[model samples]
Target: MQALRKYGDPEYWNKRYSTASGTFDWYFEYHPFIAQILDGFNSKEISILDVGCGNSKFSEILVSKGYKKITCIDYSKAFFEHLFQEFHERLPSVHYMYMDARMLSFPEASFDVVFDKGLLDSALTGELSYVNAKQIIKSCLRVLKPFGKYIIISHSDMETRKEHFLDPSFDCELRCESIVVTDNDCHEGEERLPDLTFYAYIFSKHLH
Candidate 1:
């Protein structure tokens, strides 16, 4: 169990992405719900920050949709090599940085939209789970503009994940909906993996 603590370390993810098979997207990409996620927002105008962007191609897909000013930050730089190799020069248009989600370096109210696809869930499984996960969410709120949207696709249920967003400490209003997603991408066993259902949480920060 002590070794599992490395899951929270950047080096562990760096090594994984450097040697992982193919291009992987945790909890799938945002292609299916692009409209729902970006509802009432101009994708081309709003600045987006994808927190804990691993090897996910969601940012690339957003770029293709003409969403300029997309920034992806991950703790590991090793994934950058795979990104550049897969997307070529097009990736240069989207900002990529090696940064920690729990302690973002961006200024307050810096982004209009932030996406967390499986990031919080992954964090919850790591060492000091509650502290690490709460810090990430708090940092997201701090960096997000008033009325900005934080979209999270997590494997955890609403009961488990909602408290962080609804906590009195944070000034935000949240709504969640369940989505049935196929886990065929998971290769855990020979038997077919069950169709997994999870929640899509959208938390809009109240104007201060």
Candidate 2:
């Protein structure tokens, strides 16, 4: 629990992301297929909320591809202040705000899509990890427009994250897919080369 406390602190994240050398995307970088998923939502008119937006360059990619309304929110104000200063010229369209994901302040049905990359992982480390994660998901659901997709990329398998969606408490539909990566760097017949895979969960908010 104490571990969760330390991680949930805004100051901790601010410090962790303050150094340039320390900045790196968690787990995998934005995959090309994910980019294709974004491209499918063409019309260039969708609003995206990147929850727990740390130092990842995902938003920059979205902006480069002409995504007009991209908002990145984190609890750490200092981290975003630094990011804003760093990418001001390139991210005029990106809105960086500091807010806790468990208690989002947005009005209902405010976003077309809400994305979470490893936010649940971080929340899972806390004392009330499951509870916190539920709050975060429900909060995200509240802000998503009817039929909006909440895409979460995580290293956690179905055994871990599947329960939150299965509780019957959330009014949403869920689908999860595993991402397989074939490391060509390894020999073709290498015994150790099993699929390098992870899971991406997508929850669709039901229209009331």
lDDT of 2 by residue, 1-208 (tens): 5655766555677787666432367766577657766776665789999999887888887887788899998887667656656765667778988899999999999998999988887877766778998999999988999878888888878897777767677778888888776555666677665656778888888777
Local distance difference test values of all predictions, in order = 0.79, 0.80
**Model 2 misplaced regions, further than 4 Å:** 1-11, 21-23, 182-195
Clashing pairs in 1: none
Q: List ranges where model 1 is wrong by over 4 Å.
A: 1-6, 81-88, 182-194
What range of 10 consecutive residues in model 1 has the weakest lDDT sum?
81-90
Q: Write the per-residue lDDT of candidate 1 for residues 57-165, one digit (tens) a residue.
A: 8887887787888998888777776554564465778888879899999999999998988788777778788898889989998999988888888877877776666
Global fold similarity of model 2 (TM-score): 0.85
Angstrom error of the Cα, residue 20, model 1: value is 3.9
lDDT for model 2 comes to 0.80
Q: After superposition, how far is residue 188 of candidate 2 from its true place, in Å?
A: 15
* Minimal lDDT window, size 10, model 2: 20-29
RMSD of each: 3.8, 3.5
Candidate that would win on lDDT: 2
